[model samples]
Every structure is written in structure tokens, then in C-alpha cells.
Target chain A: MKIAMPDGSRKEMTVSVARIDEILKELNINPVEVVVAKNGKIVPEEETASCADELKIVRIVHGG
Target chain B: MLNDLEKKRYSRQIRLFGEDGQAKLKKAGAFIAGAGGLGSVISIYMAAAGFGKIRIVDCDSVELSNLNRQVLHWSDDVGRSKARSAKDTLEGINPEIEVEALEETISKENIDQLLSGCSLIMDAMDNFSTRYILNKAALQKKIPLFHGAICGYQGQATTVIPGKTACLRCTFPRAPPVTTFPALGSTCGVIGSIQVTEAVKYVLGFGGLLENRLMLWDGLSCSMDEVACMRNPGCQDCSALIGDANYKQEMSK
Candidate 1:
């Protein structure tokens, strides 16, 4: 599967995990700190990511 | 019915939304959660746009270091309370509207009383803990929250319509580590303007709100991007409210 990070970089990774949260954990990214979208639609934390061709993870935080 | 002075004051915007829209704006109350960088911009715009009543809360005193981004406070106001400075500046911009500035820290205790009668809540807070408090309040009141935050040249904004769209906790389950962050005034202007725009649209009942979308702004690249978002069924803040009549009806479909 291909994953796109917030910095506009893509990484190819092979994982046998079915859930998106597990994939994020394998990539050393905290699932609770970022929003994950499969293809174009946002998926819930427990949703399956094994069938997705493209994945995007965006960190949601700011200073104000 | 707009008086002659108000009609002339908001002529340009009235042309966009008409008398009815202007009236709607005049009848709504907006709660601003801060009086700092983002709050400065949000309150300024909300006041100028005629948001009838505005209640802004802050506990900090102005300092020389805050002059770079907190536009509402001037160098002479270095020792003054931020809420007082903000009230003076907002009233100076638009005397026709009512500005109620409170010099108190926003916490779970007074959150409900502070937000009473407010039609909308604008998130201009500096920390996530306070933002979470405002979010939970908005959810309980079934009021919309226009959220904006800025750090240096980057900023992000989103709108939360309670159970109708993704709540703040749904999008950000964990708060980022708190630290003193570098900030630029222009970044606050960008995100804050978008938030005020969302509030105006929501009050006027027109245009597409930023529902289920998180807008990210990068000033360095001069690029803007939006990421999709959705409600989390197990969200700690808003999950229980999902069983409300309105949410249940929408979910049933």
C-alpha cells in the first residue's frame, strides 16, 4: 500500500494488518494524534485499511 | 429593520446577504475564547461584521512580547489586562455592537455560564485543554464551533456543528504537547479570517460551511490543503449526544 504523509511525501509499505490504526502503529505514528483517510474519504479509527490503494495521514495540531 | 446608520455602515455586506442576513447577524451572539493573536483577528472581524453581541474572555496581561501578533494590545497596554485591551479595541472598531470582555480564566466550572445565550463559539485559545472545554460546551449546547489555530507560518481551521459533523475530539483524540510556539501575525489573520467567514455564513444560513473538512494553511509554500474528517462513534466528548433526536434522524438515513 502507498501512504502519503503531511509533508507531501509518499512511502510504500507492505503490511498484513487489516486496521488503519495498526498500520499507523507499524509506521511509528500515533493514530490518536493524526487523522487518517483512505482513498479520499475519512475512515474511522477501527476501520479496515487493507483494501485501500492510497492512504493519507495528517497531523492535526496548531499553536494559537 | 435597520436604522439609517446601520444601513450605511454595513452597505457593502448588506448587498451580499441583504437586509435579512444583516438582521440575522445583528441578532446573534458570538463567544470568543481568547483575546490573543487569533482572538484579536476573530473579534475584530466579528465586531466589524455586526455580530450584535460578543463575549470575549482572557486572563493574561499584555506584555512587550505579545505586540508582534496580538494586534488588539498596543505597546502602551503592556501592563493592562488582555480582555480590557481587546474590549477597547473592538469597541473602537464598531461602537454599534456590544462587546463584553471578561477577565477570567476559562475552565470547566464557568464554561456553561460564560457561553450562555451565545449562538456560536469561536476557538481562539492557545492551548488544547481550553479548546477541549469550549468544544464540550459547544456540543452540549448544540452550537457550532469555528476553530482556528496558528503557529509561525502554518495554521489550520475547522468547523464543528456538534453531532452533525466531526467534533474536535473526533478529529484530534489527543492534545499535542504544550509549548511556547513561534508565531506570526499574518498566519493568525489567515486562519482567523476563515473562522469569521464561517461564522458569518452560518448566521446568514448560506454558503458551504467547512463541515467535515480540516483546512491547513502553509504560508511558506503559499499553499492551502484540506483533509477530510468524520465523527468517531466512540468519541469521549460527543458520543453520548449522537443519540439525540436530530443526530439519530441523520444517522438513521
Candidate 2:
């Protein structure tokens, strides 16, 4: 499946996991201070563990 | 139907804006929330500019401390409800227009009813909770919201157009943790004038509204910046709207 990123890049990945952390780790990302948007919608923090989709990640914290 | 006196009274602005612009102003209905510092200036300008209908909402009564900034209220108006005072002052400026004074707090339950049928909503509120509620209502109703906030010598203004542009939440997912910030009366004047500018421009169909851009002014440094921004697809409010639409389509069972 093609996973979309916030920067509008597509990555080919085959993963059977629904959690955001799983996808992040698979993509070599640490899940701290990172916000995930799946298919252009914000995945609430509570649902991040259960929601499944082709994902786009947006990092929220750093420099203002 | 404007008369000769009305035309002459507003001749200067009319000459610059022309008859069509004057007509647009006369037809617009503006809902101003919070008749405090910012609302004071915003109400005056909108009234002076000849917006046909304006609703001023506020729950507080004018106090002695409000004299420094709230120019709309006189010493005689003290101890009177701010909304009523604002209405009185606005009408005094132009007796031809209609002004409604709603002396009540804009709670979550009543926001929609208060804002319904208005062309635009201007938020001059001091608290974040109320502003958030306004933002949600604006998005849900698809009304253009002009937001202005001030602290000390600094102020920020932005325009949010439902699904078309980034919202206040997109910029700050959560309200800033700080409450009880300092604010100068002049800062309110500066920011509130910009809010009025945006509202008039929107009403008159003038060139490019300040969508997706945060206009910041710092009286301390005398600097201004237009921070360009875009819609955050990840914004909960934006995303929820998208979800509900898709959900409705799929669940047509």
C-alpha cells in the first residue's frame, strides 16, 4: 500500500498494523513529540493506537 | 434608502469607497462578541462606516476601570450593561443603522443562536474558552471569522474561512497555557482596528481577505509580520467535518 506523508511524498510499505507507533517505528521514526495525520485528518492521541489507515505524519513540536 | 444628510455625513468615506461600497456596508450584518477594549473600537468603526445591522454581545456592566479604553461608554454609562451602552453609543454615531445589544455571555449552548444569520463574526473576547467556542461555531456555520488577540504591547489577528483556511487551533492546537496576561488599552485599539479593516474588506468584496495569514503587530518593537500559513488537514475540527461527511455517505443504510 502507498502511505502518504505530510510533505506530499508517497512511500511503498506493506504493514498489517493499525497503531501509529508501529507505522512510525517501521518508517524509522521515534514517536515522541510527533503528531500523526491519516489521510489528511488528525488522529486523536487516544485513537492513535487503534486507528488504521494509509498515514501522513506531522511533527508538531520544535521551533515556534 | 440613504438621504442627502446621510450622504453628506459619510461623504469622505463614501467618496473614497464609492456608492457600491457604501451600499455593501449598509447591507452587511456584523456580530461582535465582547464589547470590551477591542469591541469598543470595532463597534465604533463599524457604526461610523454604516454597517446596516450590528449586534454587540457582552455580559458585563461598565465599570470605573473601563474608562481608560472603552471610549464608547461614558461616566453616565457606568454601572450599566456594556452591551446596552455599546448599542447606545453605536446608534448615537449613526441613527440610521440598526444596533442590537445582547447583554449575555456567549456560552457554548447559545453561540450558534447568537451568530446565526450574521454575515461575519468578530471575536474581541479576552478568554480562550469563548474564542474556541466561537471558532467551532464559525467553522460549523461556514461563516467567516475575524480573530484578534492582544497582550501587553503585542497583538495578533487572523481570518478563518471554515474549510478553506487554517483555524486558530491549527496554529495552536491547544490554547496557550498562560491565562491572565497583560494588555495595554492602545494595543486593543491597534488590533481591533485591523479586525474592523478585515471585516469591512470582507463585507465590501474588496481585494484579498487575510486568509491563512497571521498578522502580528508589536507596539513595543514597532514591527509587523505576515506569517503565511495553510490549512492543517490534521486539525481535529477540519478532520471531523471531513469524517462526518464521509460517514454520512457510507452509512446511507
Candidate 3:
């Protein structure tokens, strides 16, 4: 699945992670700093994901 | 009621959207929640654009460190309150607009009072905790909150319309580890200017807003991208308005 990485880049990867939280964890991303979208739909971190689903991680840090 | 002086002063922009659009701007009241980097730029543009009433609040006194991005306060005004300096600068830029400068900290108790009479809220705050407060107040008051934030070379902005889009809490449920993040005046300029632009369009009743879209500006790469966001049904802050279809339909037009 195509995943839009946070550094303004895109990468296609095969992953076995089932839950969105684990996918973020595997990427070493802090969940607080990003909103993960699965197949163009925003999902909570607890939602399940599969290797066939495309994902995008949008980082939302820095408040000022 | 564009008098001779006011008409001449705003003539350039008046040529674009006509006097009625300018009048809509003149009738709008905007509240800015900070007086630092983003606030400096946001208030300046809002005042210059003829946004009728502007109230800015900041509890801190200016220091030498703030000179880097707080354009409203100069070296001579170091010891003075940021809110006062902001008022001085904004009034000086455009004497036609009313400017209220308050030296007060925003809290849950006073958030509603601070936003009273203001039709729009400009989120120039430096932290998410306060942004959350502004978000809740905006939802309760049913006003649009123009959210802009910056760090180093990256910045983000989104327009939160109460009952219509995903509120700030929906996107940023947890505050990031707050620390002294690096800042640049240019980044604040880009983001804050966008916030003012959003406020102008919102008040003038024209242009598509950043609703449900998080605009990410990456200065390092010089790219602007947006991610779609939706109103979280289970969001603690905005869950009350789960099905406000009428407001959404009218506002979308």
C-alpha cells in the first residue's frame, strides 16, 4: 500500500500491522503528533488496518 | 457608512470586492489570543484590511528574545506589555479600526468573556492547551476560529467552523510535548497571513475556507499540502453537534 510519509515523501511498503497504533509505532512516530488516514479516510489510532490499505500520516506538531 | 477618509483609505481593496465587501469587513469583530509572532502579523493585517474591531490579549511583558519574531514590539518597547505594543502598532498602521489591548491571561473561566462580542477568533496562541480552550469557546459561541501555528520552517493552518467542520480537538486530541520550539518570523508571517486571509474571506462571506483541510506549509521544501479531516463523532469537545445539517448546508453556500 502507498503511504505518504511525514517528511514530504511517499513510500510503498508491505506491512503486517493490523492496528493503526502499531503501524504508527513501527514508524517510530508519536501518535500525538500525527493523524493517520487509511485509504483517504481519517481513522482513529485504534482502528484496524491491513497491508492492502493505503495510508497517510499527517504530522501536526508545533502550536506557535 | 464609508466616509470620505475611510473610502479613500480602503480604495485599493474596495476596487476588488466593492464597497459592500469592504463594509462587511468593517462590521467584523476579531479577537486575537496572542501577541507574539503570529499575533503580530495577524493583527497587523486584520487592522490594515479594515476589520472593524480587533481585541488582542497577551499577559507577558516583551523581552529582548521576542524581538526575533514579535514584530509589534520593538527594542525600545521591551519592558512594555505585548498587548499594548500590539495595539499601538495596529492603530498606527490603520487608525480607522478600533483596537483593544488587554494584558490578561486566557483561562477556562475567562475565555468566554475574552471572546465576548467578537464574531471571529484568531488562534495566534503558542500552545495547544490554550488552543483547545479557544476551540471549546468557539464551539460554544458558534463562531469560526482561524487556527494558525508555526515552528521553525514549518507551519499549519485550518479554519474551524462551529457545527460544520472538524474542530481543533478532533485533529489534535493530545497536545504535543510542549517545549521552546524553534521559531522563524517568516514562518509565522506565512501562517498568520493565511489566518487573516481566512478571517477576511469568512467575514466577507466569500471564498472557500480551509474547512476540514489542514494546510501544511513546509518551508524547507517549499511545498503546500493539505490532509483531509472530518468531524470526529466521539470528539469530546464537538460531540454535541453531531448532526447539525442545516447550519452546514447554509454555511457551505
Candidate 4:
């Protein structure tokens, strides 16, 4: 299986039931502030682990 | 003489922004919540600047104490509803503009009705509960909301542009438990002016708003600073409006 990471890059991997956060740690990318958008819609924080396939992650930053 | 009237009526500002900015002022509509302290200054400026429509909502009557910062009322105007006095004063300043005052408080139930047709909502309210309610309503309706709070010589202003900016909840998830605080008249004036400036900028589609920046003022120090903030993806109020059911369940009453 191929997983889409937050930076719009894809990584080929074996099938595993891992959350996006776990996948991020595996890639050594620890985003401090972020929201998950899977297939173009916002995924609730509570539902982040449930999201699967072709997901996009959005990061929020403190801006002035 | 028509140009003369424009030049004389807005002579100071015309020299600063020119006629295009003045025309923008003539077509704006603003909803101001709380007709006391800060509201008085905001409404007066909006009306004087020729905003086409001004809506003011406040349920309280003027007391002698309010005379300090609420300059729109006179000794005779005491005992009258703040909203009513505000309407009369604002209309007197610019009768060509439409000023509507509702002797009602804005709650979760009635906020939408009060804000209908208004391009921006100004939270001149003193209490946190009402401000929070107005904040949620404004974000849900996708209306720009300018928030101002004053305590003594300290006050802050922030412009929340729905999906485009960090909302009130993103900065302060819960209201400060204190309901009453000592405030100086200059405090309200400083903060209210900033709020109205942001409101006008939002209405005129001007350069850019103070989005994502909490502008804090300290009159005692004569200093101002802009602190950066971001949308707390877990903020109970805005997160729910953005479609987070879990946060909604946690905050739902």
C-alpha cells in the first residue's frame, strides 16, 4: 500500500492499521499544530485515526 | 459647493484617505453590540463617517456611572435606554444615515436577528458571556466580528474573519470568570477606535485586516503590540462550527 503524507508526497508501504500521527513519526515529521483532511474534507480530531487512504494533512501556524 | 460640502464635512479625513475612502464609508453597514462605553464611540464614528446603516443592541438603561465613557448621553439622557440614546445622538450627527437601536440584549437566541443584513459585528460588550455568544454567532454566520475588551488602561482588539482568521475562541477558549472590572474612559476610547477602524477596513475591502493578530494596548505604557494566534483545531466553539462533533458534544448544553 502507498500512503500519502502531509507534504503531498507518497511513500510505498505494507498495509498496516496505523494512525496518521504514527505514520508521521515513522517519517520523522512531528507537526506541532495540524488538522487532518482526508480526500479534501476536514477530519475531526477524534476521527483522525479512522481516516484512511489518500489523506491530506493541513498544518495551522500562529500568524499575525 | 457639493465638493465643498464633502471637503468641509470630512476635511480632515479627506486629506488623509481622499474621496474614494469617503465613498466607501457611505456604503457600509455595521452592527454594534452594547451601546454603553465602547459602543458610544464606535457608533458615533460610524455615523459621522457616513455609514449607511447602523444597528445597536443593548438592553440596559443609562446610569450616572456610564456618563464617564458613554459620551453620547447627557444628564437628561439618563434613565433612557442606552441604545435609544445612542440612536438619537448618532442620527443627530448624520441624519442622512439610518440608525436603528434595539432595547434588547444579544443572546444566543436573538443574535442572528440583530445582525441580519449587517456586514460586520462589533463586540463592544463588557461581559465575557455575551461576547462569547456573539463570537460564536458571527463565526457561524461567516460575518466579520471585531472584538474589543477594556480593563483599566489595558485593552485589546482583534478582527475575526471566520474561515480566514483566528477567531475569539482560538485565542481564549474560555471566558475569564470575572464579570466586573474597573475601566478607564480612555481605555474604551482607545480600544473602540481600533475596533471601528478594523470594522471599516473589513467593510471597504481595504488593504488587509488585523486577522490572526491580537492587538493589545497599554495606555499606561503608551505601547501597542500584536500577538500572533492560530485557530485551535480543538476549540470547542469554532471547532464545532467547523464540523467537529466531538467538541460539539463536549460543549453542548
Candidate 1 lDDT over A1-64, as tens digits, reads 8898866688987765478888888889876556787886677767876644678887755577
C-alpha lDDT score of every prediction, in listed order: 0.89, 0.75, 0.88, 0.72
TM-score of chain A of each: 0.81, 0.61, 0.82, 0.53
Model 1 over residues B107-160: C-alpha lDDT tens digits? 999999999889999999988999999999998888999999888888899999
Candidate 4, residues B47-89, lDDT tens digits: the string is: 8877778998889898998887888888899899888888889
- Which sections of candidate 2 miss by over 4 Å? A1-64, B243-253
Per-residue lDDT of B128-212 in model 3, one digit per residue for the tens? 9899999999988899999998888899999999877899998787887787888989999999999999998998788999999
Q: Score the docking of each candidate (DockQ).
A: 0.58, 0.04, 0.62, 0.03
Where does model 1 exceed 4 Å of error? Answer: A16-22, A30-32, A44-48, B250-253
Model 1 clashing residue pairs (backbone): none
Error of 4 at B225 (Å): 2.1
Give the lDDT of residue B202 in candidate 2. Answer: 85
Q: Order the candidates by DockQ, highest first.
A: 3, 1, 2, 4
lDDT of 1 at B244: 87
**1 against 2, candidate with superior lDDT:** 1
Identify the CAPRI category of the predicted complex in candidate 4. Answer: incorrect
Q: Model 3, stretches more than 4 Å misplaced?
A: B243-253
Question: Alpha-carbon error at B21 in model 2, in Å?
Answer: 1.1
How far in Å is the alpha carbon of A53 misplaced in model 2?
Answer: 31
Candidates sorted by lDDT, descending order?
1, 3, 2, 4
